[model samples]
Target: MTSVDITEARKTDAPATPVIEAKDLTRHFKVGRGFSRQMLHAVDDVNFSIGHQEIVALAGESGSGKSTIARLLAGVYKPTGGEIFYQGRAMSTFKSRKDQLAYRGDVPMVFQDPFSSLNPAFRVSHGILRSLKLHRPEFSRPQREEEAARVIETVGLTPAGDIMHRYPYELSGGQRQRIGFAQALAHKPKLILADEPVSMLDVSIRIGLLNLMAELRRSEGVSFLYITHDIASARYVADRLMIMYAGHIVESGPAESVLANPKHPYTDLLLGAVPDPRAPLAEGIEGDTGEPPKVIDPTPGCRFRWRCPLAIDRCHVETPLPRRLGENHEAACHVAEPDPGFRE
Candidate 1:
């Protein structure tokens, strides 16, 4: 008998509160000497929301500022403009360390480099135990050990006994990565900021991590902001997708829809470049293919016009804001249109 995929069926009701949200979130940095100083736009005027038990992938090239957004949400860097709200409450209200602890406990981050993220000196159990000690003070010594073992197993590191005693240097790349997930699991976070968690692993290993994320979301009711450059992996696991470029979110919507009917010229180009295993490889992508400029005190215009084929005079003078294309789908483009039409 054929089994039904229940993932789509479970989306009938909306969560009571948005797990986390960004309202025009912006972060910038000053670079160079005093006379030649300029503000580097790391992340600018970004907005999105993650609901309970959902996976949202922020896809972009290396310097596209997707990681900056992750850091902003994780509290590593504060937003220069706009605000972050968690469960309908503005983060600004939580000023003190004590006040922020609860929010921090509810959200954990898994870094990109797994081996570097964990300490080489300590056994694998050290971080998980520390996380539990800080976030779950209620658990006693025995309970903490039990909880750590459980989380380690939850990430598919079997026997927990065999895994817990080893140091970071003892494990393989994939095992080290699973330990990263286990560390976050110890917090029992509502949302996880996974900053390219699988990018550093081998191709076969990536599928395991991706499936682990889906399992965590399904089994624990956790949400995630999966940041990656590979749209294929994003498509494999994400329910929603946001495309970032030059510190701006050029397009966003449900993942499958955005991939199927890309509304922005940049989005279309990104999809075109993704390799199709069944089909033969193609020549270079047709557009300019130039690197996006370093956004230092950028002017009001579409940043992608330098490479976008459909760019017009209007794109040079005015910045495009995200326009709705379909249900929960939008793109920031001056020329592209919805289904049944494409024009200026």
Candidate 2:
């Protein structure tokens, strides 16, 4: 993704409603031994909404629960707590497998590694044709072929017929990635959740792919939930941003505001980690130095207190919920709240 942060664009239409809404969404895994055995809070009380035609980027360090949340959204893992709604209807309310299938038709996912996502045994055309059949089984075989060619072309593959016949190993990384994008679009899904969609591609092709996603949002009114660790890239593709740390959202707001004036200590650390050509490069944000704390029967206090430079006694004793700090901005930090010294 591009590093440049353009000014935020205002929406002219009625604020588009969320196509995906996750309220207090959570996922816990049971691990460890006797007495230590406890629930690993992989995703902890996460809440956010991705509106129609909007792109909401989830930025965080690895193990901050971005991937876990994405899996939950994709129905690969059911949440342990909270609820997920697609277009305001509870996901659980879908009674039959057919209803569940219909609900999923509205949302599709694009994985990080295009090479792995496509089948090695199938040719590019076969891979895409299968996806089209699954996503819209009603489409006739000829219609499916036309749709596959159209989507492949939309993602910038030239002479779709030639590329479609090539096997996965035969295409360049960018071309394989374009095929992945084509698979997602074949269904004309209303929401797309991309997990580090361009991280594995060569730098030369990164911008082109990001620009393609941006163009799709602008032209087709497709909603996106883009997950990435690169703060610089997030600024380029996101409409609003949410910064997550230790399985919790530390700060969230318009991309410009959060990038320009980060409110939380953790968020500051993240932004400061971005590479800067003009500014002297200091020690970047450190990676996870120790194994994640046992998620099972975890401590009740702030999960980030051990690494937080601003931690106080209170931070070690109680978990702080989100506190609003500005218009469309919120932070889950005691220091950023009205009474920074109230921790005593």
Candidate 3:
């Protein structure tokens, strides 16, 4: 794995000003009948900020609301409560379509399945040109095509000309993903909401795609909200990490710090579950292990208490406030004692 400079990444040249911020961001869906209906807390009271040029990974198992948070940040889903800000301005108040369009230009998304995301009918070149044409009409057809070719090359799709006429099915999974990258980059977005960008690709190609993204961070300064269930990749790519469970942020800190020294029990479970071939595999957690807790109209207490090994009486009775564990490290747990053997 490539080593990331977490210290320098944490200390931005400019004081950390969130290019995108979500304050108590939440979304709940009503499930079941009127009498028995319960709200499904997809994302509840989640808060975080992404500084300019920062890559923050949102890690959790399925149903952890990581994808829901991604959708909310992308403006695909409106928050049921709390506020969203873009560069300190209220994103919710971006009333005008033109205003929203302008803001969206700065943020584009790369979905998990590149094959499904891209149009099957349209040629790769045509699809890219379509976005460019709609977003930048000033550019003539040739100019758009030229820029498209450049972008395709930038994403490591060498001999970009050969792939222009190909359909999504014609290319390999990695190549198709590169095409998605090209599409997202066509707008020169300041922030890219990548939800498991490499999850569907072949294992061998995952590293190359990750390297490409890291290169984009260095060369273009594009911030990323990389959503993934894979903790190892999160550790590899994220400057910082946010652990989510049952619609809430359970822990967050520098990726190395969180991985090395998990404060929350949920965080510890996540790190413990990472597959390490070299070490003797430890016994896994029991009772629906590796899955996030249920979120159905949850009572006013901790969601993970049901599965948490460290759960106490207080954990079952009330929600735990976020406790400071270390510098820039915080975890929402009643029993977040610092571990002495913490290091990356």
Candidate 4:
């Protein structure tokens, strides 16, 4: 198991219990039947953690398996390799339906599309009420209504009474997304797995959602595993940043440290891919247009060699192990030089 070397202490100097921890966690899909059965590597040996009240951004392009990791942590998809520890408890020990439900309640998922996540036929209150019934069974229907209203207001939607009566269609994209969060809050979760929650919203509206996440961490002490391809938004909300490529966590560190000095070629590539509003307009976006590799029965080497500028011969034959770049900074690259005074 690859240790999450970059993990931070949630309280004192000592390491606090991570809300979610993955130890060489992996997941693969069966693509074909019997004779032609092929494994499509969705998430491969992913190791990371979300400290108490910490926001860890899992940034990657499509097919990078960011969403799969979210589902794995949420107990929706069973892992094919390794184990997941929630607040230091091994998920493998959870064998019964009651245990599974408890885990789901503790870690609720907020998906990308707000409209699709909620039922159009039902009013907005349906999901929150149902979540309360399933998870917080102690709450009566009246108490659920009051708690639901509080959560709606918590997400910055005022007059919860008015919003609760409306259907998913009546709300704006941003409002619908906040409603998704409200439903998750009904579970009284310790952690939230938000998968591209703002990518579909307008640029101005995106910032508001990002700010809401930051506030959630500050006010509620809730941790978040924010998965998205947008590096800029990731930097804004995440305390720690992890870059994924071809189903592997290629880099991880403090958000500022990783963004300013990306150790992996893939991390650098992702940052370079972000737009600079200050720069003049261009006919076409510059940089390598290479797509991330499709890993189906993948070879035993770096999956990013096809597009990496710093790929050496070592990257072709042997898979590169993550080497320390600095304190709380590591990058999986064979030829990447240490920044200044790194030991390994």
Candidate 5:
């Protein structure tokens, strides 16, 4: 649907408390052959929350562990260490069949590649119908078909009659993505883990999908954890922004505040890279030339030390704890001075 229609669908209600919380979550993988096995710290001591109907963007470059965190939240991978709570209940305790089934219904995911998630052997409607039957078995055949069509229309694929019959290979990338959204919506989920949902689509189609997600949050009260590498898109769609580097969250806060006055050197480097017509081409952060540290058996100190322009002796010896920079704003940097503009 159009942006105007999506905005008009918003609800007027007070914000709700967090529906998902990750406390000191860590996930490590073993790399290399059996004799030379080494730990690859994919997600290290990361913590964050997603409130009801909120959209939190996780932004970082490739290999920064953004996708790893998303997988952990979606319950695709049990964290090697730490815990995940859904609506205040521990996810690890969901060992019973009934509990696992309930949790799956409550949390659905939209993958990065729409083609990979769909079945080429069946029509698009069959996938949505299958999800409906699995999640809402009470519905009869007619009800299931009606619900599927309604959701497909909700994602802005007009005249569901025409689109439902098309196979995955018959549709374009954008059409397949809309079907992905339809499939996720079929579950009537409380939250969605969107792993780079727009990174694979044409640039022109990205904004429309983002708008549809915002519409879902507004009208259906569905929360979203948007994982992406593009800082500009994150700023546009997120209520909160978390910046990750080498598996650690170095900075996080409300989107506008963090983007306006970035406290971490890595965050500044990322923001500077975004093309801005107002700024001259010469304006950019220097000393960001070195390669990111290998995640295998990483050092104890700050992971960004080798490339930070403001690195000091202490940064190489001790890891910096997350320090408060402003209201709801925190950064992990030994030398990041609190901006006077944010002082009480």
Candidate 6:
């Protein structure tokens, strides 16, 4: 077994404290009519941590529970089970109004759709100013306005004065998304849960938004939980990557290492789906085609068994515990094996 050195993978002297941590974090929704209620496990037994100034990308296909995890972290949805911790403090303990306010100020979210996330009736500056007023009440009215303009410029919206006054419908999709980033920045948050912030923007503008995020991480020491389905974009921006399938985090580790050598079959399948210029048309991983398993009233066992080619009897009867592949890499698979071509 090839072991990866965690310290080397970090490549930076980040602080020891974790910005956010999820311990057995699970969120299940009750679905169906009164007599036929069933549980939909959106996020199940997920465990991971993001350190200060780190960018952890949560990658999966649609309905893989990536957005649900983001909502849980952002405190939009209360967990059906498990706990979330921020800076070593349990989120459940923040029951007091004051504590909840403080937590929200420190942790802000950027939603997927810029058009819908922002208020259509209000000007762009109104959204940014509102966040600043809520999070930074100490700032005077003039200071708040100045800070709002600064953040707009910070997010790559040039001529902040002109852009700030426009309504959501007035700006282009890319510009509106930049406004979303500006709103998140207005709070000076310790952590940002960006749920597909760039998925809706134009291809020409995707790189610009990604570069802005990278700049924030470098300049401001902001930690991010970037949720997306694009593995290629995740690799381009994140330091660490977590792969989810059927509400389970099947693989996670340093981004470079995991992408170069995936242990789990699901991870391999996701990577194979990424568009490659060199590969011939219709050339990709075969036989793994089907709708994802239904989450409602899910049966016990590996959820990926229906699509996994390597699944065996044990896989159908038992749930595999996460096996340590290296110092920081882990995969939940009964038949996981090292790739011979993989190298550190």
lDDT of 5: 0.88
Which lDDT tens digits does candidate 6 get at residues 1-344? 00132223333655687999999999999889889988898988999999998889999999999999988888889988899999999999999888898898788899899889989988999988988888788999999989999999888888999998888899998889889888989989899899999998888888777777777776666889999999988988888899999899999988988998898999989988988899999685875965577688788789888888888999878887787776578899999874555433
Error of 6 at 210 (Å): 0.5
Which ten residues in a row are the worst by lDDT in model 5?
5-14
How high is the CA lDDT of each candidate model?
0.88, 0.81, 0.84, 0.86, 0.88, 0.86
**Regions of model 4 farther than 4 Å from truth:** 1-15, 278-292
Residue-wise lDDT of candidate 1 within 1-344, one digit each (tens)?
A: 00123244224355778899999999999999989999999888999999998889999888889999988888889889999999998988889887688778888999999879999999999999999999999999999999999999999998899899999999999999999999999999999999999989999788889888888887888899999999988887888999999999999988888998889888888888888786666566778576575589988899999998888999989999988877778899899777654332
Output the lDDT of residue 29, model 3: 90
lDDT for residue 189 in candidate 1, whole number 0-100: 95
- Writing each residue's lDDT as its tens digit, candidate 5 over 265-295 gives 9999899788889988787668787667668
User: On TM-score, who's better, 2 or 4?
Assistant: 4
| lDDT-best of 4 and 5 | 5
- Backbone atom clashes (below 3 Å) for every candidate: 0, 2, 0, 0, 0, 0
lDDT of 4 by residue, 1-344 (tens): 01121122222232467888999999999999989999999999888887888888999899999999998998889999999998899999998989989999989999999879989999999999999999999999899999999999999998989999999999999999999988888888899999999999999899888888877766677788999999988877777889999889999988888999888888877877787887667734333555468699998889888887777788888888777888789888987778886676
**Judged by lDDT relative to the true structure, which candidate is superior, 3 or 6?**
6
Model 1 residue 25 distance off true place after TM-score fit, in angstroms: 0.5
Question: Which candidate leads the pack in TM-score?
Answer: 1
Model 6 root mean square deviation, Cα atoms: 4.4
TM-score of each: 0.95, 0.90, 0.92, 0.93, 0.93, 0.93
The collision pairs in model 1 are none
C-alpha lDDT of residue 314 in model 6: 93
* Candidate 3: 10-residue stretch with minimal lDDT: 5-14
Q: Which lDDT tens digits does candidate 3 get at residues 117-157?
A: 88898888876887788777789989999989988998998
Please give the ranking of all candidate structures by TM-score, highest first, separated by commas.
Answer: 1, 5, 6, 4, 3, 2
